[model samples]
Target: MIEIFGIPLSAFLSQLLLGLVNGSFYAMLSLGLAVIFGMLNIINFAHGALYMMGAFLAWMGLEYLGLNYWAMLLLAPLAVGVLGILIERLMLRWLYKLDHLYGLLLTFGITLVAEGVFRSFYGVSGQRYAVPDLLTGATDLGFMVLPNYRAWVVVASITVCLAVWALIEKTTLGATLRAGTENPRLVQAFGINVPRMVTLTYAGGVALAAFAGVLAAPILQVQPLMGSNLIIVVFAVVVIGGMGSILGSILTGLGLGVIEGLTKVFYPEASNTVVFLIMDIVLLIRPAGLFGKER
Candidate 1:
């Protein structure tokens, strides 16, 4: 067997592919967190719960409404966005008048209730969602067989991340968003509706998370506990990338995913803990994160 770095090349590549998929999810979720935190100064703990809701919504669409994967991709995130708007209007809206800690507590409580409601009904046995017909096969690349669904996930996620990065980093609206977060009162004085913008920003971040959830449904089991399981890991990625840099979040996510994947190939027992270990080391050495500015 041909090997690279004392490991079979096939094994190494396979783990790398798996890591890329995992990184896609991490990047999307952390992007949401970064956007919300940067703009609202709110640590939205409900993000993962909302992500679970998105997957469940896609599943329900297929099971009861005869909706296809494409439809779910378009509608699930919108549904999640609408729900996020409601949360902003009802709960988060009030916290803007108070300390940022209150916003964190409010969202954390929402996470608990959201996860609990789903658990009461789903009971966490895991719900299976089939990949769309178009993505159900495997492709042979001579050296290895790649699952179409996984490939699609990696491509789609990277595309979305780049689009988001371009939007915020290159476009005027992105500039305004960043500026508004820094000084909402000034932006408002300049004729921007900062409050509404703030709401939309949160909704946008939530939509990204929901979109990732829908993408994940067919590959991972749709279960109430899924979001909770992923939340801490994504948080670790956010910490390592810095909560303020969008590009940093995306890069760290994909890079960490590959590193974690390689760890699995070389040392399966340490794969799960590798990300956290990196996080601790990063914190000790660079507390502001890999791409974060020191405060």
Candidate 2:
């Protein structure tokens, strides 16, 4: 058996794969945060709550309506996105002209209320979500047995990340969004509906979080607190990657996951803290973040 650094190569590969899977989740969630902050300047403390709602929506749909994972993939986001739109129009929009802290406080309160309601109904126990039949097995890669579901997760995450990046970086609509972020009044002066754009952007960002939750359902159990557990790490990823850069979020998230995984193998005690350590180092060096432009 070939060994790398005195550890079996297969063991190392498995860990790397696990890290990549985790990074996928981080990338998607952080990307959503970046988009919302970039466009609306809202801290969105309720994002984790929205993510939890997505998973519950999926679970409920499955349990009550016989909706499969594939259908929930579309339905969950749409449902969550609509809810986000409602929040934006009815609640978040009024805060745009005020201090950013107000937005954060409101969202935090929203998080508390949402989490309390769900915990009351579901308790802390996780609900099971089986892998779809189409992706239920494992494949031998000579060195590692790669689970099909995990592979699907990695591929789906990467695709979504890339698609979002392109939408925000390449398209004409994306240009308008960026311009609005820089100066909404000017964009509105040019006849663009800035308020509408802001509302849609928030909805889109929320939908992205919901989409990630749906993706995570099979791998992680559906629970009220699942999103809360991961949201802080994801926020760290956003800060490390730079809050508004799409590509930065993607790369930083994946890189941190790989680093975290490597830490588990080489220094088990530091695995959980490695990402935060890197974030601290990055902040010390570039306060604006790895990809953010200094204001």
Candidate 3:
């Protein structure tokens, strides 16, 4: 068997694939954060809770409503998105003019509340979500066997990320959103409802988080604290990529995941801290982040 860097090639490939799967989650989660921060200037600390909500919603739907994975894939996000709309209309709208710290605090409180509410009902134990029938098997990829569900995750995440990127960076509506956030008065003068647009933008970002949650439910155990477990690392990814940079978040997230996976292979002890170590180095070197422009 061929080996790379003293590790068996098959093992390396398997780890690499695992890394990419992790990267897909990172990309999706960070993309949502980037959209919210970049466009709304709000530090959404409740994102993880919302993600947890998404997964739980999916699980609940499956359990009670007889909804399948495919159905929850669309419904869960929509449900979360509507909740996001309420959050924006009821609470977040009032804080837009204040400091980013306020938004962070408010969202943090929301996160606590959300997690508490779920924990009260569900406790800390994780719930299982079975993989869909169509994606239940594994594929032989010459050397390494790839799980269909994991491959779907990577493809789905990339597709969503790219679609969002294009929507924000290329389309006319994206231009309007950018313009609205940058100069709301100017957009408002053109007969656009800036407030509504902003609300929708926030909702969209929240929906993205929910979408990621649905994707993760089958792979990871669903639980109230699951979001909290991953949110800190995800925040590190966002910081390293740049607070509000779309492309930066996507690339940094994926890169960090792969780096973490590789670290697990070579130096298992440092696997957990590798991303943060890189984050520290990045902050020292380019405080603005890799794809972020210094503001």
Q: Note the Cα lDDT for every prediction shown.
A: 0.92, 0.91, 0.94
In angstroms, how far off is 165's CA in candidate 2?
0.7
Question: TM-score for each prediction?
Answer: 0.97, 0.97, 0.99
Candidate 3 or 2, higher lDDT = 3
Which predicted model would earn the best TM-score?
Answer: 3
Q: Per-residue alpha-carbon lDDT of model 3 for 66-119, expressed as tens digits?
A: 999999999999999999999999999999899999999999999999999999
Sort by TM-score, best first.
3, 2, 1
- State candidate 3's TM-score: 0.99
Give candidate 1 regions above 4 Å deviation: none
- Model 3: ten consecutive residues of lowest lDDT: 286-295
- The candidates, ranked best first by lDDT, are 3, 1, 2
Model 3 bad stretches (over 4 Å): none
Candidate 2 on 177-265: residue-level lDDT in tens?
99998888899999999888988999999999999899888888999888889888998999999987788899898888888888888
Minimal lDDT window, size 10, model 1: 93-102
